[model samples]
Target: MTLSTQERTGPGDQAATGVVAIEATRLEKSFGNAAVLRGLDMKVRDGEVVAIFGANGAGKTTLLRILATLTRPDHGTVSIYGNDLAREAERARLSLGAVLHSPMLYGDMTVEENLKFFGRMFRVPGLSARVLEIADRMGLTPRLDQRVRELSHGYRKRAALARALLHRPRVLLLDEAETGLDEPARQVLDSVIAEHRAAGHAVVMTTHSVERGIAASDRVLVLAGGRFALDEPSSSVTLTDVTRFYIEPEPGDA
Candidate 1:
């Protein structure tokens, strides 16, 4: 079935639950036979917080890249808000707010300047108002005069988040979003996610901290060997399940 035929515009529920924001099926990605992803499948519902966890080189980043539309899969199909990524990239991308590991900011640009630049790119209405609003929420208005180079890691993250929201995307794709956050700063990120969740936005986050990931997510996915070895909900399962799956016994020693 195609994506556009699905209902993804409003905050609808999935069957008796919530509406799905992202639906990926038979996802496959390979780097010249490296086989980063193997028939991966995932479903994220609106207002749901999904966290992904895996060891290094486990295709976690590769899967996120496909979900963010930064990279494409060789074999599987992806759809966002029912729009096919391969067929209509623009329409599929318009509903996304992304924060990848890469920084797309200029060091010389002030916080406001950077926001305005991206605002223009999306032709976001009420640009100035939205900028100020997000700035205040992120505590960036005080650093409006500071260039991207002069800010600390936490503030820079806030600024980057502001830049992403310039277009008011329906879904948030965060890659290591809380890497540099302090206790208070991390709290803010939590607040941001909660606020967005309350506002009916879907979120897919990649995190290294298992505790934080479990606390923040409704569902958890562990991608290893280009496939999901474990897919379960945080509420019903314990960390022991993931540990048992990841930590295998010695080879032929038992």
Candidate 2:
């Protein structure tokens, strides 16, 4: 059963809210002759940063899409905050805010306009105030009227982040969120993620950079050749471990 609002009456999402924020079991997906995921079991608790790492075309995008409710899994059960993804799709979707590499915004619109539009889509109360809050928080107040396409990569990334945070989703799925970002852009992404983590939302991101992944994530998962391969806590694993795992696989490289 889903937790009641009474669970959140106290500070933070109250304990009455059972912890398993995101859960996937034996997930499988295939594209004709190619298989993207194979019996992968993944889980992320509330208020945590879990980063999934993978080489190019290692099914990371597929996994992110499935979890974000953007794509259907060929087989398996998934849940977000105690709500079933397949059985209660709308409920499950309401709990998630996703940012893929595409930014998922209208480039023709202004930064503030795009955020306001997304706020309206989520039916957020006080849409204008919320838009301004996000804009200010992301240092976008100066470029509020700038068209999204006219902005630099860094500002566009910030705009995308603002859109994701508009409704305060319980889970944030970031598929390659840090890709194509310069130093400053990457810093902004890191700071925004920190903000999300501090706000008690479960964040799951996919990245190619081990350093960035470890720095931003509480846990690291390596998906090799389209399977849920290596999973470990970020604090416990070092860059050496990441290098070794990538350069050389164990005896069970199946």
The model with the greatest TM-score is 1
- Candidate 1 local distance difference test against the native: 0.76
Q: Give the per-residue Cα lDDT of candidate 1 at 56.
A: 66
Best by lDDT: 2
In order of appearance, the predictions have TM-scores of 0.88, 0.86
- TM-score of model 1 (CA atoms): 0.88
Residue 61, model 2, lDDT: 88
Off by over 4 Å in 2: 1-18, 247-254
lDDT of 2 by residue, 75-159 (tens): 9988998788999978888788898888887889999899988888789999999888888887889999999999988788778
TM-score of 2: 0.86
Candidate 1 Cα RMSD after full superposition onto the native fold (Å) = 5.3
